[model samples]
Structure formats: structure tokens, C-alpha cells
Target: MRLAELSERSGVSTATIKYYLRERLLPPGRRITATQSEYDEEHLRRLRLVRALIQVGRIPVGTAREVLAAVEDDSRDQLSRLGTAVEALPHGPEPDESDPSTAVGRRTATALMRQAGWRFSLGIADEFPAFRMLVGAIAALHRLGYACDLPHLLPYAQQAAQLAVADLDLVEEFTTPAEQVEAAVALTVLYEPVLLSLRRLAEAEESNRRFGGGS
Candidate 1:
């Protein structure tokens, strides 16, 4: 398809598409004529991946480039590396940081968790660190004075639980319960450090942004 058509289909602007091409974020399209190029499915796929990383995952361009490179490599560890990168979504500003000690917000969130007698699911702990991060985010919010009202956040939790169940069920074919539990624990430990490190780095980057030092 033509650049105009690609841009319209991808919901990205023409200039942005050109920028992506210049950055080599998008693969080179076929040069159909001296002044014309035609993009194909590969280009569309690359554009979608870039959009997911940039728009949905909130990853920075530099990091996304590295991640895309790692995922595309033919090395044995490429899948694992891609999995890790997928889990490293940008967490934007912590809502807890806004007002961590409120009775109806962050604090309320914690109290509700304790009341619900919730235990960290071992099934997910080993496979996805987002569970641990969610817990940490809640705790951090409580510490920062936000009232984590259980009632208010219950809908979000319910939706998350539904998604978790679906995900677990989907993966049941790949591993047994015992193996899943082990993987969950391993994933949690492995991802914890990565999460902390990335968060620190993000903080520094955010600081630079505030100080007019970041591009």
C-alpha cells in the first residue's frame, strides 16, 4: 500500500510514518518507483509493534529499539528476552505518590486487602511480576498517604481477577500446576530486580524531563 494508505490504516500520521522509517523503526518498504514506495504486511506488523510499545506500553523510543532488536535476533534467548521486555511496560507516575496517606484512597486499599484475606497467588507470582508490582504499588500508595478505598478499587480488582483466571487457564496446557507455581516464584524474583531498576531509571528520566534536560 502507499504511504498515505498505511498511515490511515495504522492511525499514525504521515510525518510520523516518515519519522519511523528514518529511525529504522520501520523496515524499508519496496521502492516501486523513483518517487514511490509500497509497504507490505511486514511493514504493517512492524508499525503495530511500534505502536504497542510506544502508545500502549509507554516505552521510550531508545528502549523500544533495543527491545525490538533483541526480539528480532535469532539467538536462543530471544524469546525469553522478548518476554522480559513485554513485561517492562512503562508505569507512568505512581498514583500513590500523589497523596499516599488518605483514609479513603491508598490506605483504604490496603485495609481492604487485609480484610479480604488475600494471599499472593503462587500461580502468577512465578510467571508475571505485575502481581508483586501491584502489591508494591498499593503499599507504596498507602505509605504515601493515599486512601486506597477498597470499594472504589474493587471493580478494577475484579476485572483483573477475571483476566488472571483467563490467562492461567490459557497457560494450563503448557505446564502443570506444580510447574506453574515454581515458574511464578522464579518469575517474581527475577522480575523484581528488573522492575526496581527500571523504576529508578524512569525516575531519573522523569527528573530530567522536569528539569528540561530530557529530549
Candidate 2:
């Protein structure tokens, strides 16, 4: 299709599309004439991916480019592609290993993972900022008077591991590495809110059943 049609169909402004082209975020279209260019389904798919990463995932352009590069890299295995996608997602600040609170949090996180039998290495955790964020969250919960101990948190980790397996199964449905990466990102970024919303609803229903006057 023409540039206007591509923009219209993708819900991206022509100006932004031009900018993406200039920035090398989106590849150049097939030149039909000296000035006219045609875009195909692949272009549409890539545009959607770029938009999702930037607009929905809130990834910066440079990081988005790197993520795209990783996704498009045919040399990388499925696990590596998945890891790259996870790395590109937003994360909190890295926790200080020397800080007593962070140290406790790391131990708690490590214990939870070990109890759940989740296969992760300390090296992987150290490289991923989100791991630190997870630990920070546990520590913060403890500070906020919540039960952040291993026994209490193990159930959550177990459930998360189950969900991760399901997520991987879904990713396997896509034949191509790019498709798998896109599916992983979309599943993580888009469905996170859906999952949270459902959890909140479940909590409300449970509370109402147990404590509401209707009970």
C-alpha cells in the first residue's frame, strides 16, 4: 500500500512514519517510482511492533531499536530472543547489593525461586535489573508490614512459574523467531493489566463473600 494507507491502517501519523524511516526504526519501503513507495504486510507487522514497544511498553527509541535488532537476529536461539525481550522492558533502579535491605530482599527472592524450583542463575539475576526490582518489592513489602517471608511468598512464585510455562507454550505456537518475540512482548505488556484487573476482581469477590453483609 501507499504511505498514506500504511499510516491510516497502522494508526500512526505519516509524520511519525517518516521520522521512523529517517531514524531507521522502520525499514524503507519498496520504491515504486522516484517518490512513491509501497509497503507490505511485513512492514505493517513491524510498524505495529515498533508502536507497541514505544507507545505501550514505553521503551525509548534506542532501546527499542536494540530490541528490534535482537528480535530480528536469526543467529540467536529462542531463549536468547526471549531474554532480549525481557531486557527491553521497563524496570526499576538496580538495588545496591551492599545495602542490608537489598541483601535481605535478594535472599528472600533467591529462597522463593529455589523453593519454587525455578531454574535461574545468580549471574542471570545480576544482569537483569528486574530481578533487583523484584527483590526491592519484597523488601518494601516487609517494610510496609506485609508478610514477605519465604513461606508466604512461595505460593506466588509457584503460580508465576506455572504461568511462565503457559507463556512459553503459547510462544511456541508461533513458528518464526520474530513472531515469537512479538507474541512474548505483547503478551507481557498487554496482558499484564488484564491479569492484574482480574486478580483485583477476584479479591473483591472473595472479600465480599467472606465479609460482606450479603454473606
Candidate 3:
């Protein structure tokens, strides 16, 4: 196929294809004439991968190129082992576990981390802002006589993890190994904002359902 056809088929811009060619992310095409070149199916597949990484994964071009090189080196294997390695990349920022304070504060922090589906050791509780926030929220609730039991939160955490894993599996269908890593990065960066916004919207609608229209 020609560059224009490839772009049209892949929903990628011609200029982006040219940029990928210049970056050597896509292999060279056939030289059909002095100026005209013909790209094949492999180029199309590679472009799909590139689009997933750049637009969906949001990877920096330099890092994405390195990831593509890894894919190339591993392309001949019976299994796409490098792709699996890429998907196994960490999804979020690592925690810092250097604090030594203990007692009620630490226990509350640990419980909140549990609620958030984080599986790190208790020693790392001081490192997660979400963990700390959860602790504070639960503590405030308790002081206001609205305390929740840990067991009650456990099921919610489990269900949430199941949903997240399902969501990642769904995204896997359209992504390559490098793009998988990129998508994971993108999910980590954007999911919180998106989910928080949705949560507020849902809460508003539920409030209307419960209190609005004189019902």
C-alpha cells in the first residue's frame, strides 16, 4: 500500500507515518520507482503499534523507539516474550518506606492501604499519600462515630481490583508490548483524574435521585 492508503487505513496522519519512518520505528518500504515507495502489511502493523504507543501509551518518542528496538530483537521468537516483559512493567510510582513511627497512626495507615488494594508491607504505609488520606478519613469518621470495620472494606478492594484487571485485559487487545507499557503508564497518569471526576458526577446524580423532584 502507499503511504496515503496506510495512513487512511490506520487512522494515522501521513505526516506521522513519515515521522515514524524518519525515526526508523517503521521498516523501510519497497522502492517501486525513483520517488514512489510501497509499504506492506508489516508497515501497517508497525504503525498500529506506533499509534498505540504514542497516542494511547503517551510514551516519549525516545523511550518508544527503544521499546520498538526491543520488540524487533524479539520478533523472531516463538512467543512474544519481550511483549510480556513490557506488560509486566510497574503501573504506578514506587513507595518510600523510610519512616519508623508506629501506634494508632500506623495501624490506620495500614488499614487504608489495604482498602486501596495496595499489597505493600506495613512499613511502607508512610509513603503513600492515598494511604495517609484514607487513614485520616477513616480516623475522622471514627471520631464522628461513623467508624467502618476493616472486613467491610476488604470486599470492596477485592472487587475494585477485579474490575481494574478486567479493564487492562480489554485494553490489551489493541496494544503491543511497548504500547502495553505505555498504556499502563497512561492509565496510571490519567485514570485517577478521570475516575475522580466520574465519581463526583455519579454522586451528584445520585443526590438528585434521592432528594430532587420531591422524592
Candidate 4:
């Protein structure tokens, strides 16, 4: 495809596409002439990945470049490539420093992960941004004077572990490392709402079952 076609197909402006090429965020296409280049489907795939990293993920250009490099690094194994890609994504923001629960939550988060047997899932405690998000959530409950400790959270952890396994199973259905990694990233961001909504629905059903309040 030509630059204009690539731009239209990718829903990105030609100007922005030129900028991405100059930024080396997207690899240049094959040279057909001094001023013309021919792009293929791989360029299309990469353009979307670059856009997702920048626009949806809100990662910096530098980080996105590093992530793309990692994704394209054939020397690395599939798991390593995917791990690097995922770790590059932003988890939610850190809990407020002023909140005492931030400290308490960090401790609780560590203990909970250890009890759940996932402390080493990323080869270190407090490594993934999701771990930080967990800390913030636990901290919030603690701030509310609730027992948001390991015992209280273990069942949820067990269920989440199962979901994690299922997520990996789905990612593996893709034939390539890049495709699998893209699926992993997409599922990570997109499925949280699905999971959360289902939880709420389940709670409603269980509540109605126990209380006889529904038709």
C-alpha cells in the first residue's frame, strides 16, 4: 500500500504517519522510488501496535520504542518478548503518599501475594504495576477500617490465579510471539471491565438467591 492508503486504513493521518516514520516508531517501508515507498500488512500491524502503545497505553515514545524493539527482538523467546511488552504498560497510578494505608497496603499486598504463591510470578515482589494497583486497592480497604489482609483476600487471589491461567491459554492460541503478546496486552486492558461486571452480576444473583428478592 501507499502512504495515503496506509494512513486511511490505519485511521491515522498521513502527517502523523510521517512523524512516526521519522520517529522510527514505525519501520520504513520498501523503497519503490526516491520518494515512494511500498508498505505491507506487517507495517499495518506495527502501526496499530505503535498507536496502541502511545494512544491507549499512554506510554512515552521512548518506552514505546523500547517495547517495539523488544517485540521485534527475535533473539528473545516468546515468553520473554511478551513479558517485556506487558511490563512496559502502565498499571494504574500509585496510591497517595499521604495515605497511611499506602504503607499498610504495601505490606498487606506483599503478604497476600506470598500467601497466594504469586510473589515470584514476575521473579520479584512489587515488580509489576498490577502489584502496585493491588497495593492501592488493599490500602483503600484498610483505610476504611476493614480487614483487607491475606486471609481476607486469598479466595480472590485463587480465583484470579485461575483467570491468569485462562488468559495465558487464550494468548497461546495465537501462532506468533508478537500476536500472542498483542493478545495478552489487549486482554489485560479490555477484559478487566468484563471481569468486574460479571463479578457484580454474580453478586446480584447470589444476593437474590439468598434473600428471595428477585423474580
Candidate 5:
């Protein structure tokens, strides 16, 4: 299809598509003439991915570009591609390692992972802000007089690991490398809120069952 059809199908404006073309976010369509080009399903898919990254995931264009580049780079293996996509996500500001709280949080995170026997790549925890957030949550709970020791947290870690395996299995279902990359990116960015909402609902149901008055 032409640019107009691509824009219509994607719900993206032709002007924005032109911008993406210039930014190299969307690959050039087939050149039919000096000024005319035609796009295909691949372009449509890429446009949708770019839109989701920017509009829904709230990823910066630069970061989205890096992710797109990683997705398209056929030289890298699947794991490397997924790692690159993850690394392109925005993270919180680096903690001051010298701070006592930061030091304690890091130590707690390390201990929890060790006790849980969670196998991870070297330095992966250090690079992931989500891990740091987990550390901070544990520290905060401890400060509030709640025990967040390894034994207390092991169940959650085990459940999360199982979920991660399931997520990877879903990614493996896509036949093409591009489809797998798209699936990985979409699931990573989109399913987080769904998971959190489900957890919240489950907690509410459990609380109501245990504490609510008969009605």
C-alpha cells in the first residue's frame, strides 16, 4: 500500500510516518518511482511497534530507536536481542553506593537472590532498576519493623521465576525472529500493568474472604 493506506491502517499520521522514516525508525518502503513508494505488512507491524513504544510504553524516541535496532539486528541471538531491548528501557537514577541505606539494600538484594538460588547473568542485578526497586522495598519493609528475610520472600521469588519461564515460552511460539522480538517487546511493555492489576484484584479478593463481614 501507499503511505496514505499505511497511515490509515496504522492510525498514525502521514506526517508522523515521514518523521519516522527520516529518523530511521521505520524502514524505507519499496521504491516504485523517484517519489512514490509502497509499504507492506512489515512496515505496518514496525509502525505499530514504534507507536506502542512511544505512546503506550512512554519510551523516549531515542530509546525506542535503540530497541528497534536491536530487534532488526539479525547477527545477535535471541537472548542478546531480548537483553538489548530490556537495556534500552528507562531506569531510575543511580543510587549513591556510599549511602548506608543503599549499601544495605544492595546487600539485602544479593542475599535474597543467593538464598532463593535464582540463577542470573553476572552483573544483571546491578544493571536492572527493577532489582534495585525490589531491594529498596525490602529495606523499607525492614525499616517499618516488618521482617523481609529471605525465607519470607522466597515464595514470591519462586512465583516470579515461574512467570518468567512462562513469558519466555510464549515468546518462543512466534515463528519469525521479528515476530519474536515484537512479542517480547509488546509483552514486556504492555503486560506489566495487567499483571499488577491482577495481583491487586487477587489481594482484594483474599482480604474480603478473610475479613469481610457476612453479606
Candidate 6:
């Protein structure tokens, strides 16, 4: 299709599509003439991914470039591609390992992972993006005078493990690496609210059962 058709199909403006091409977020279309280019399904797929990352995921352009590179890198296996994409996400800001308080949190975080047997790549667990998120949350909870102890965290960790398995199973349901990787990215960004809402609803039900409170 032409640029106009692409824009219409994607529900994005032609100006925005031009911007994406200029930014190299979307691959350049095939040259049909000196001034015009032809787009195909591949361009559409890439455009959708770019839009999802930038619009829905709110990923910065530089980060999206890195993530798109990771996603399109056919050299790596599918799992590696998924990991690379995940590493680019803002699970938490870069950790301050030098800060004593952050170090304390890191220790607790690692301890929790250890007790839960949450296996990770050797020496890379501490560097995982979510590791920083966990450390920050635990540290903040400690500052709030809450016990960020294993007993309280173990069930969450177990549930996370189960969720990971289920997520991977869903990813594996797609046969192609591209489809699987895209599913992983989409689910990672989109499903957190679903899980969080379910948790809250379950808590409410439990509260009602125990306290006999009105909805």
C-alpha cells in the first residue's frame, strides 16, 4: 500500500508515519519511484510494534530503538530476544549500588530471591531490571517500618513463578519467533493491570467473607 493507505490502516497520521520513518523506528519502505515508496505487511507489523512501545508502553524513543533492535535481532534465540526487550523496560530506575541504604535493600532482595529459589542467570540476577524494582520497594517498605520479610514475600514469589510459567506457556503457543516475542512484549506491558485488579478484587472478596462488609 501507499503511505496514505498505511496511515489509514494503522489509524496513525501520515505525518506521524513520516516521523517514524525519519526516526528509523519504522523501516524504510521499498522504493517505487524517486518520490514514492511502497509499504507491505512487514512495515505494518513494525509500525504496530513501535506504536505499542511508544504509545501504550510509554517507552522513550532511544529505549524503543534498543528494544526494537532486540526484537528484530534474528541472531538471538527467541528467549534471549524476549529477555533483551525486557531489560530495556523501566522496571525501575538504575539502582544505586554504592548507597548503603540501597545496598541494604539489595541484600534483602537477593535474600528473598534466594529463599524463594528464584533462579536467574548466574551473576545477572542483581542486574535484572525487576531486581531494582524489588530492591526499591523492599527498601521503601522498610523505611515505612514494615517488615519486608520472607514469610510475607514467599507467597508472592511463588505466584510470580507460576505467572512466569503461564506467560511462557502462552508465548510458546505462537509458532513463530516474531509472534511469540511480540506476544511477550504485549503481555508484559498490558497484563499488569489485569493481575493487579484481580488481586484487589480477591482481597475485597476475602474482606467481605471475613468481615461481612457491604460491596
lDDT of 2 at 164: 82
Residue 53, model 1: lDDT of 66
Which candidate model has the greater TM-score, 2 or 3? 2
Of 4 and 5, the candidate ahead on TM-score is: 5
Best by TM-score, which number?
2
TM-score of each: 0.46, 0.89, 0.50, 0.80, 0.87, 0.88
User: How much is the lDDT of residue 81 in candidate 1?
Assistant: 52
Taken over the whole model, the C-alpha lDDT of each candidate is 0.60, 0.82, 0.63, 0.82, 0.83, 0.83
Q: Compose the digit string of candidate 3's lDDT tens values, residues 11-44.
A: 8898988899999878889989988799987788
Q: Clashing pairs in model 3?
A: none
Where model 4 places Cα greater than 4 Å from the true spot, the runs are 54-63, 95-100, 200-212
- Model 1 stretches with alpha carbons more than 4 Å out: 32-35, 56-58, 74-82, 92-132, 141-162, 165-215
lDDT of 2 at 214: 52
Q: Which residues of candidate 5, in runs, are more than 4 Å off?
A: 128-130, 136-146
Candidate 4 structure quality by residue, lDDT tens digits, 1-215:
99999999999999999999999999999999999999998899888878777776677888878777777778888878887777776677888879888999988888777787674653565667678888898988999998887788999999998999999998889887777777777667566678889999999999998897676
Work out candidate 6's RMSD over C-alphas: 2.1
Encode model 5's per-residue lDDT on 1-215: one tens digit a residue.
99999999999999999999999999999999999999999999999889888888898888889989888988999888877876676655565555566667678778878877765732588766677777677766766668777778888888988988988899899899878988888778877888899999998888888899523
RMSD of 3: 7.2
* Stretches > 4 Å off in candidate 2: 121-123, 213-215
Residue runs of model 6 more than 4 Å from their true location after superposition: 96-99, 213-215
Q: Of the pair 1 and 4, which is ahead by TM-score?
A: 4
Q: In model 3, which range of ten residues has the least summed lDDT?
A: 94-103
Model 6 agreement with the true structure over 1-215: per-residue lDDT tens digits? 99999999999899999999999889899999999999998788788888888888888899888887888898998778999987877676665666566776778888888887766742587667788888888877766678777788888888998999988898799788987887788778777778889999999899998899656
Q: Write the residue-wise lDDT of candidate 2 on 76-147 in tens digits.
A: 888888888777777766775666777778889887767776656455775676677889888778666788
